[model samples]
Target: MTVLVSGGSKCGKSRYAEDIISKSGIDKKYYIATMQPFGEEAHLAIERHRKMREGKGFLTLEQYTDIEKAEISLQSAVLIECMGNLCANEMFSDSAVEDPVSKIVSGIKKLSERAGLLVIVTNEVFSDGIEYESGTMEYIKAMGEINSRISAFADVVTECVYGIPVAVKGDV
Candidate 1:
C-alpha cells in the first residue's frame, strides 16, 4: 500500500505520515529521510525531526540522494519524508538528470513494491499560486507534475490544511 501526504511547510504532513506508520500494525518500521543537513539551520531542523521520530521509536536511515538503494535494502514498512527534497537533489545532481517527474515516479514505484507499506510525504507546491520568475515557474511546474504522478500511484492521497488532513483519495 502507498500513502501520499502533501501539504505546505509546517502543515503537519510529516506528522500525518508518521501517525499512519505507527498505527499500520507493521512490526518493523524504517524512516527513509531524504533531507541533507546543509547548515546550522538545516542541521537543527533535521535534529528536531530526528528527535520527533525517536519519540516514536522509529529506525531512521538517512538516504540523501538515492531512493533506489534504500528501497532495495528495506524489508519493513518505510516512510519517505518529503519528495520535494529528493527531487531537488536529483535535479541538482551530476547524474543523467533527465526528466525529474519520470525519475520520481519510477523511484516511488520501486520503493512501494519493496516495502510493506510506503508512506510518502511531499509539499503541496501547486496551491502556492503562480510564480513570476522563470526559474520559479519551472520549478513549480516540475513539482506539480511530480505531485500528480505520485497521487496517481498513491493508495491514499491526503492534503493537509491548517494541520488537518482532508482526504483527496482513499479512505480518511
Candidate 2:
C-alpha cells in the first residue's frame, strides 16, 4: 500500500506517518530520510527528528536524491520522511535533471513496488498564497503537481492539520 501523508510544517504529519508505518505489522521498517542539513535551524530540526525516532525500529537511509540508487533499496515497510527536500535536492543537485517531480515520482513507484507498504510524507505548498521569486514559484508548482500524482498512486491520502489528520482520499 502506498500512503501519502501531507501537511504544513510542524504539523505532526511525520509522527502520523511514523505511527501508521510502525503498526503496519511489517518486520523491517526503513526510514528514508531525504533532508540535508544546511543551517542551524535545519540541523536542530534534524536532531529533533532523530530524537523522535530514537527507540523506534527504524533503519534510516539518507537518500537525498535518486532514491532508486539507495543502498538498502527497500524493506517490508518504507517511510519517506518528506518530498520537499528530495525535490529541492534533485532540482539543485550537481547533475541537473529535467522534471525532478517526475523523476521522484518514478522513484516512489519503484519503492512502492519493492515494499509491502510505502508511507510518503509531503509538504503543502499553496496554502500561504504568498508570492515568491520565479525559482520558488517553480518549486511550488512542482510540489503541487507531484503531490497530486503521488495521491493517485497512494492507497490512502491524508493531510495533517494542526496535528490532526484530515482524510483527503481513501481511509487511514
lDDT of 1 at 72: 37
Clashing pairs in 2: none
Could you report the Cα RMSD, in angstroms, for every candidate shown?
1.8, 1.3
lDDT of 1 by residue, 1-172 (tens): 9898989989888888899988987878888888888989888978888877876767788876767777434556789987888888877667737787787788788988888889989887776566568756766778888888888878899998888999999964
Candidate 1: lDDT over CA atoms? 0.82
For model 2, the stretches where C-alpha displacement exceeds 4 angstroms are 72-75
User: What is the TM-score of each predicted model, taking all chains together?
Assistant: 0.91, 0.95
Tens-digit per-residue lDDT, 82-142, candidate 2: 8999998998879869879889888888888988889999999887989999999999999
Residue ranges of candidate 1 with Cα displaced over 4 Å: 71-75, 130-132
Judge candidate 2 at residue 34 and give its lDDT. 92
Instruction: Give the candidate number with the greatest lDDT.
Output: 2
